[model samples]
Target chain A: DTAVSQTPKYLVTQMGNDKSIKCEQNLGHDTMYWYKQDSKKFLKIMFSYNNKELIINETVPNRFSPKSPDKAHLNLHINSLELGDSAVYFCASSRFRTSGNEQFFGPGTRLTVL
Target chain B: AQSVAQPEDQVNVAEGNPLTVKCTYSVSGNPYLFWYVQYPNRGLQFLLKYITGDNLVKGSYGFEAEFNKSQTSFHLKKPSALVSDSALYFCAVRAQNTGTASKLTFGTGTRLQVTL
Candidate 1:
């Protein structure tokens, strides 16, 4: 079974367009996170949610918002996407109190802005 | 604030040869360090982690890491590397005292090239 999964594996949109990426995890984890990997392969945490509560919010722009409808799901919505938004977005989950506190990541969604 | 640093941008090794990927971290208190590997067109996969216990932690695919508190380093090592082991490796860390909400800070990542 795929522990963590993301939808819309590939998305190509024009500038000023809005898009959303959905993520779900069956690991029964309490925490979910969104990360962005730039062209240079630099990975950075964008947002984190625990039990549907916003926990970690990095210095990301307001144009990007993350919503967690339930503990099992966290979705990212990008408003007025720009060329800079072209990168790979990854979703991850973990049980915070777990011994190792290791996280599992999804396949990732590649976003292209033209 | 916690942070991780992987000094090497790339490390090349031949099959049957041992390999090491260096990682260092800094945190206010103790640190929970992790190592993740990523293949082309794929997401990051958890490899190993150092929470507390033994300084040497063993992980998947014949991989292990040694945690040195004094040096603030957690380096991934493999006795014999395989060509399939070629991929991008990332090191991450999170502060210990920060609640369950603490976010992990990742390194710039090191690309490992294991050739025959």
Candidate 2:
């Protein structure tokens, strides 16, 4: 079974277009996270939710918002997408909201804004 | 703030030879280090981690890493390099005492190229 999964593996849209990427995890984990990887392969954490509660919110812009309906799902919505939003976004899950836990990542959603 | 550094942008190795990818980290307190691998167009795969206990940690795909507190490094190593092992590797660190909100910081990544 696919432990962590994300919808729309590839997305191509124009500037000012709004988009949303959905993520789900079946590992029975209590924590979920969102990460962004740039063209240079630099990965950074964008947001994290533990048991449906917002736990970590990095220095991401207000245009980026993350919503967690439950413990198993965390979705990202980008408003007024700009050219700088062209990159791969990854969804991850861990056992808990602890630093020692290793996160399981999904296949990732490649978002390209023209 | 926790940060990780991977000095080499790419490491080339021949098949059947051993390979090593260096990594260093800095944090205010103890660190939870991890190694992840990314194949072409794929997400990051957890290879190994060092939270506590033994300094040497063994992970998937015949990969291992040694954590050195004195040097603040966790270098990934493999006994034999395979052609399929060519991929981008990332080193990440999380500060243990930074509460539950602490996030994992990743390095720029090192591309391992294994040639025949």
Candidate 3:
């Protein structure tokens, strides 16, 4: 069974448009995260939610918002997609709030804002 | 302020040869280190981790890592690398700033190319 999964594996939209990507985890993990992988293959964390509560909010722009209706799901919404927003988005989950827990990741969503 | 660094951008090895991917970290308190692998067009897969046990930790796919506290390093290693072992490897550390459920700081990543 897939532990973590993301919807719309590929996204193609025009600039200034809005888009939303959904993520779900079946591992019953308490923590979920959103990451952005740039063209340089650098993966950076954007947001993290623990038990549906906002835990970590990185230096990301306000145009990007993450919503976690519950611990099992976290969704990312982009208000105004820009050319720079074209990258691969990854979702991850981990159990417990411990320090050394391993995170499970989902198949990334490739977003292309033309 | 926790961070990890992968000095090597790429490491090439021949099949049946041993391989090593170097990783160093900096953190306030004891670190929680991890190693993840990513194949082309796939998501990151957890390979191994170091919490607070034996310095040497074994992980999936015949991979292991040695946690050196004095050096603040957790390097991934394999006994016999296969061509299929070629992938991008990432090292991450859990930040201890918040004292709560902390966020992970990842390294730049090292690409492993195992040739036949």
Candidate 3 C-alpha error for residue A108, in Å: 0.6
Encode model 3's per-residue lDDT on B6-49: one tens digit a residue.
99999999999999999999998788889999999999999998
Q: Model 2, B1-116: lDDT tens per residue?
A: 67899999999999999999999999988999999999999999999999999999999999999999999999999999999999999999988867575478999999999999
Per-residue CA lDDT of candidate 3, range A1-86, in tens? Answer: 98899999999999999999999999989999999999988999999999899988999999999999999999999998999999
> Which residue segments of model 3 deviate by more than 4 Å?
B96-98
lDDT of each: 0.94, 0.95, 0.93
TM-score of chain B of each: 0.97, 0.97, 0.96
Clashing pairs in 3: none
Per-model TM-score versus the true fold: 0.98, 0.97, 0.97
TM-score of chain A of 2: 0.97
> What DockQ do the predictions score, one after another?
0.78, 0.74, 0.72
Instruction: Show model 2 residue runs off by greater than 4 Å.
Output: A97-99
User: By TM-score, how accurate is candidate 2?
Assistant: 0.97
Residues A1-114 of candidate 2: C-alpha lDDT, one tens digit per residue? 999999999999999999999999999999999999999989999999999999999999999999999999999999999999999999999977555899999999999999
Best by DockQ: 1
Native RMSD of candidate 2 (Å): 1.0
